[model samples]
Target: MSSVCVNQALTDDELRWVLTRLDSDKDKEVFGLVCKRWLHLQSTDRKKLAARAGPHMLRRLASRFTQIVELDLSQSISRSFYPGVTDSDLVVIAEGFKCLRVLNLHNCKGITDTGLASIGRCLSLLQFLDVSYCRKLSDKGLSAVAEGCHDLRTLHLAGCRFITDETLKSLAERCRTLEALGLQGCTNITDSGLAELVKGCRKIKTLDINKCSNVGDAGVSVVAEACASSLKTLKLLDCYKVGNESISSLAQFCKNLETLIIGGCRDISDESIILLADSCKDSLKNLRMDWCLNISDSSLSCILNQCKNLEALDVGCCEEVTDIAFQDLGSDNVLGLKVLKVSNCPKITVTGIGKLLEKCISLEYLDVRSLPHVTQVRCSEAGLEFPKSCKVNFSGSLTEPDVLL
Candidate 1:
């Protein structure tokens, strides 16, 4: 025991092996703190990072995590005072991490077209980019990305008000492999842009035009027709211009649609919704028709009867939906339903919701808030009858502990 003394240190590869075994980021950080060599190795091996975005912080990150593939520089509401990541910071990011694939600058108000252009010029391998709520970003910035990142797959430009049809045209011309595109709150984007987009980018699978007020049936119909086989998730929430024609087109052509959110699309009638339920019954899982004033028992009954695989159903604010819709619910109907939201339905009482709970044994979430006929006392009484795992929202406000379960 006194004769043998092993002074050999673990090799870099061995240290990396150990680093890979660590599950938590805290454990990895502790490993890095063991020595400068370990820190360097950890930094080099790091492929993803989420940190506060600033010129100095980004520069340091770029220098340390040269191999980073995913970078989240999303600004939180609490940190609004700090000046966010800017064009110069992006330049540093582009130069440092050439292989960067996913970049999320969500809510980074300081990021403008110049910063995005820098990313486009350098990060050609970039695939998924989320610039959601970056109000300063216009078509000019995104067009540069479309031209450069040919393999771009998922791009979320939600709340980028300045983004117009020009960006769509650019994307259609260049990013043919684009699959998921989020144009939510891009009010400037209309049917013309969508038509042009689907013409070239027919591989698009998930499209979210939620709150794109100008987008109507013409644009959505084009998307349904062009990406009919590929389209899976279509969210048109608050797209007032979207009517029965769009839903009909989707039901007719896009048979594989999985998640369809027509919430706030008042123009959607029971006929179109029933058609949608009938057409996409097999594939449709999550269906949301919140604020679709015309949807009644007919549409609800049709959905419950047809969409057996339905997991999440939200008919909130649907003025016409009543207890009659739940009358025919059987043990087979919506068996897999996990989330049921019938909030603000003036006609739906606790009885209707209770009937739904009985049928939806797998129900995990039940939102019965704002039901004029259903009081908190009734909800509390009904809460005991709900599924064991179910969480009920009796009151409209989430903060109200008395009415929530």
Candidate 2:
């Protein structure tokens, strides 16, 4: 199901030319067949070229393959990807990738309501569409998709910032089969929008509202009351208006929750977060309380003691935690943890992080950047070794940006 081949045959300069030459589109077939190693590049490398490298490059990349089931031009793209981008751009992307099952155009700054209308044309086969972080996208764009993409299941418009209750209402009523919906950072959404969503999409499994500041207990209560049983993952990060009461209601109602992220809610107490984590310990796989200033060592310790299934934790900026908090979470218990990021926490030293390295044998990613000990930990003299597959970035707190966590 997976394969990785290193491009060792070409020098760095040669590889650069091959990728640059890929823009011409005509060289793609021969580019794909240049060697057996080049085949893997087709799947993984195409997106990189589309995002960080060049948007026009995707046209050449898209031309190489006969079938493109998914296309993600999400957070990474800095510009447009169409030959003649307009309000009609979404239609263009839709039509070109005719067989597209998934389309992601998050943060495409140039995209607007008109371009979004073009996306309705893609509705037949498009099941997943993420237009989040796109400041220009509005209800007109969403309405087109809702009316046309009858088969859509997941729609993420988080941070579109302009969408109101009308858009949410249309989506809920029209896309009855919708499952995962992320309306995070939509400043204008309120109880009206949320009520419509809850009433319409009873089957929604994941709801992400990381920073929709306007949503209050009224908006959240609808989800707690209606979508509680079916909810699997919920993200309420930085939603300052949502207090502990709302969080508690969510925990009590959404018993089947698997992943919960409530980072940056300053008003919510550490006690509430701890209670939620402890309550969902068995099923909670990923929990991020980053920048939750109220969460101290006591609450985090509670999480460690109760949440044995936790695999990824972000306790960044929790100044109260010390080495004692990690004492209970030795490597023996967290064998499945792949990412351990605790950047910017003051209490932990690189030496404290050694406890994790000593225990979590399957650890592949360790990021302790901005911790005080990044400069202190000796890479050569730790008497420890990283796995051949593991990657760790320890930016220093010192002038060198070195530290460990």
How accurate locally, in lDDT, is each candidate? 0.87, 0.71
RMSD of each: 3.1, 9.4
Q: Candidate 1: misplaced stretches above 4 Å?
A: 1-9, 331-334, 379-384, 399-405
Model 1 lDDT tens row, 88-120: 888888888897999988888888999989988
Q: After best superposition, candidate 2 residue 130: deviation in angstroms?
A: 3.0
**Candidate 2 Cα errors over 4 Å, as ranges:** 1-76, 80-84, 89-100, 107-111, 328-335, 349-358, 373-375, 378-390, 396-405
- Cα lDDT for residue 328, candidate 1: 81
The TM-scores of all predictions, comma-separated, are: 0.93, 0.71
Candidate 2 on 1-405: residue-level lDDT in tens? 655445655665566456666766657646667675565454434532233224355455556543677776665543445322335445546656666778877666767777777678654777898877777778888898888888889998877878899988898878888899888878798877888888888888988877788877778878887888788887877787877877777767776777777777766776777767766777777777777777777777677767767677777787777877777664456545656667788788656676666666676667677776554356446665666666776654323111111
- Clash count for candidate 1 is 0
Best by TM-score: 1
Candidate 1: give the clashing pairs. none
